[model samples]
Every structure is written in C-alpha cells, then in structure tokens.
Target: MERRDIEIFLTLAEELHFGRTAERLGVSGARVSQTIKRLERRFGVALFRRNSRHVALTPVGAALRDDVKAGYERIQQGIDRAMAAGRGFSGELRIGFSSPLVGEIIMAAAEKFRTRHPDCAVRIREIHLSDAFSALRAGELDLQITELPVREPDLSYGAPLLRDQRMLAVPSRHPIARRASVTVEDLTQSPVLVPADAPGYLLDTLVPAQAPSGRPIARVPTLTSRQELLTLVSAGQGVAVVGSQAVRFHARADITYVPIEDLPPIEYGPVWPGGAQSSRMRSFITLVRGLRQNEDDVTRSHDHEPSD
Candidate 1:
C-alpha cells in the first residue's frame, strides 16, 4: 500500500469509524469503503467487522495495525529528521543569557528543543549586565534571552516568557533586614548596588536614582559584575534591587532577599538582532514559547528568608 494509504489506515484504525475517518482524511466514506474492500480482496480476508453502529478491527487486522503503527512512527520520524536538517535546523545555535535562574530556564527549554530538532546543537554563553547589548551587536551571540526594557533600535525581543517579583537584596546587617517587607522608599537610607557601565535605563531599572516620592536613592560606585554587586550587598555596603530569582541562584549568607512590596515584577524574554533572525533562531523561539506555557514552580529555598 502507498504511504498515504498507510496514513489513512492508521488514522482510521485509531478513529474506527468510516464517516469520522473520512472526515479526518478529507475523503468520502465511499472512498474509504472502496480502499478497505480492495485491501481485503488483495489479502483475501475480512480486516474489519462493521454494521450500522459499529466498526471493529478483526484479529488479523489488529495484529497488522500493531506492527505497522510502530514502523509508521519510525518512518515519519526519519522523514522529519531529514526535513529538519534541510530546513537549517541542523546547525550550531549560540544563545546568550543572564542571571542564573534565567539561564536554568533557557537551558531547560533548550534541552526540549534538542529533543525535537536533534540535529541542531545549542551552546549557551553567559552574559553580564554590562555586556548584554555589546555582545549581541558584535555578532558574538545570535540570541540573548534576558531581562527586558530593550531600547536598542536594532534589537528585537520576544514576548515576556516569565515574570519574577522584585526583591530587595540587602546586607544581613542592614536596618531594613529587620522589616517584614521593604519598599522603594527604604533604599534612600542606604546606597543601592549598581552594575558599572550598564545602560542608564538598565541602571535605573536595577536601582533607580530616585524613589516614587522623588527622594534620591544614592548608589555605591558601580560594580563590574552581578557577583560583585551581590558581594557588596552582602558586605553591608549597599542594597540591590533584584528579582525573585536571586533567592534561588544568588543566595548568600550575608544577604537578605526581601520582596519589594510596591515595585513592578521583572519580565524576561528572548532578544535577537533585528532582521537577522534565522530558522534555528525561530525554532528556538518556538520551543521557549512552549516552555513558557507550562512553567513548573521552582523551589525558592534561600538561607536568608525575607518575607514576600
């Protein structure tokens, strides 16, 4: 039998109804009957028992279906692999990500993507807050899935994949550490940690220069990396406004991650160079979108438990 006939047979075998199968296969019920009759005559046996209200596969037909279904799946998988290879899905896809939690999230999605497009290999590169845009603009990264508020004219970002509540990272010795929850106004008493050389908007996002009340929130001299920024917070030098993810990945003995009761949550998603999107990039984006739909609750067990 032809491949199309095999497909129709498999579909019909699962559906087990002439009219329903015909509707699914986009053919007439008469045509389905004709195919079954021809196949039975060729094999000289009744493959199905049918009446007005029922359609059931006979013993021989059931055996044939069980054997063919596995083989059919293998055949389809082979064809899909070949098609994926030809569609540029069989190449290296370099991805850049920031923050350890986001990295874990993206890598989890990448694993699923590799299972779907086995030929495509994904290599994740860690991005620093100071170098998020520079790496993308330099062609060093095909895509960077990071925190948003992307203002670059040449960069495009996908929809927010996940949102995390804003948390205030403070030294265990800081005064606010005694509070149940902190607000943007409290940071005015201490210098907020900032990443050195990051864009002004990003700096503002991380540790705003002023609170909603327009009181200036002073900053410690910019730190070179996220690790350095957190280290300073741990050392009682300053507070750092960060995301809930910090509790999972950047937990430190000297720091407390208190939820900022009044600030907006941080949103993250994929960002790539404008008009430079590739088939591999598109496939990765699709996989991330799927992962976003079924996010698993992550364990937020940190040593320094601050009230949410």
Candidate 2:
C-alpha cells in the first residue's frame, strides 16, 4: 500500500471509527469510506468489520497492522535520518536531565545517537528542580528528560520515556519506614518536603497538598536539589515522595524508600522550547521513543509468558 493508504488504514485500525479517523486525518468521512472500500477491493478481503454501530479489525487486518506498524516507523525514521544528514546534523545537541535515573537513560541514548551520527556532538547536563525551564528557555539546552506535566506555554514535550511507581522517602527511624508500603491517606501523618521552585502542578505529584480523604497533607517547600531533599528527609524534617528509581540509585543509611501504594507512577519525557523543532531534537526524540517502545514491547511479552 502507498504511504497515505497505510496511514489511513492504521489510523482507522486504531480509532475503529470512520468519522473519527477522518477527523484525525483532516479528510472528509466519505473520502475515508471510499479509500477503505478501494483497499478492500484491491486486497479482495474485508479489512474491517463495520456496520451502523461499531467497527473492528478482521483477523487478517489485525495481522497486517501488527506487521506494518514497525515497518512504517522504520521507514519514517529512515526519512528523518536522511533529512537530518542533508541538513548537516553535526551541530552540538545540548541535553539536560533532572534525576539520576533520567541521566542514565540520556547517556544511553546519547551513545546510540553518537554512533549513528558521529559528526553530531551531544552534551549532557543536569537540570535542577529549582530552575526547571531556565536553561531550555535561554537556549542553553536543546532538550531535557524530566518529570511530566510540563504546562508552560513556551515548552513542548514528547511521550513519556520512563514510568515508575511513586515511593516515599523518610528517615530510617520514622515509624512508617518499617511498613511494606504506604498509602496516600497516610501522607497526612507527616509533612512532605517539596521543591521550593517548581511549578505547583509538578509539586503536586511529588508532594500533594491533601490526602484522598480531604485531610490536609502538610508540606515543607524548602528543597532545591534531590540530595538536599533527601538530607532533610533523613534529618526527620519531613518525608518526601519520589520515583521508585530513588530506591535503587539514591539509597542511603539515613533514609528509607517505601512504595506508595495509592499514588500514580511518575513519568519522564523530553521537554524543549516551543516552536519549530530542530532536526537534531527530532532525531533524539525519535531515538528515545523507539528505545522506550522496544522496552515496553519486551515487558509486555514477558508479562504474557506462561509460568511453570
């Protein structure tokens, strides 16, 4: 099938509604209908089972989708790489990371990117929570992999690259530290230490203002860095909620990391200054997304395996 045809079919397969597919593709509903009908005739099979109410892929259609999606992505990546080379993708790409876990992931992606485009130099730096967007806005960083819910008007972000369970970090001597896991309602019992300079939306994920039961969750917004936050928590100033990665990467004798059973997983993604994106930025995003997709696929496959 042609690229446009593949796009239409894939979109329809995803949406399962002709009207919504047309809306997504910015085409008329009749045009979408005609294209599917034409493809059905060419293939001599009904790709979709559609009537007045619902639509779904036929068995063959499902197989085709599974096979074509990866190839389509690879083809698009090829085009992007070619365009990037033609545009001289040799300039330095300055990237930032907010946390140690994200920093490690960025380093891995940078290695792959350098191997693929040796001429392009990749520079990595840490983006402190106290000054989240200053480096990006000032052109000091081309991109950053940080926590999600980036709502600034001048910034754009990609799909989440990493997601981990939220964990609470408290002093080792704290009463709740001995528990297997803690719930959101338990947050009311301790004051949460939070970043002093981050946006309220982001702070909410790390240290919510209230528990699920409407009880106020006291907070101490006095930290500028992860180490300082942990130090405060270790000193028994207050507890902190952080990504589960902290348990593995930031373990300390004075602090304890316990999973928050009731909180959502924290997400990290690429954020950049809003407007036209550079070829280098786009290439990096594509690489990270591809890596994340592969990891997710592997995890899903393992999840479905039959155990002895």
Best by TM-score: 2
Those runs of model 1 whose alpha carbons end farther than 4 Å from true positions after fitting are: 1-86, 296-308
1-308 per-residue lDDT for model 2 (tens digits): 98988989987886688986786566889988998899999999999999999999999898998999989988987897789778988979999999888887788889989987899999999988778999999989999999887999989876566777899998999989899999999989988888888898888866778987899999877989887887789888898888888978998998989999978899887888997678888788767766766777698799999999
Please count the clashing residue pairs in each candidate, in the order shown.
0, 0
Model 2 TM: 0.79
lDDT of each: 0.78, 0.85
Steric clash count of candidate 2: 0
Candidate 2 lDDT at 201 equals: 87
Off by over 4 Å in 2: 1-65, 306-308
Q: What is the lDDT of residue 290 in candidate 2?
A: 64
lDDT of 2 at 243: 88
Work out candidate 1's RMSD over C-alphas: 14.2
For candidate 1, lDDT tens digit of each residue in 87-150? 7577778899887777887788789878887777889999887677888899888999888777
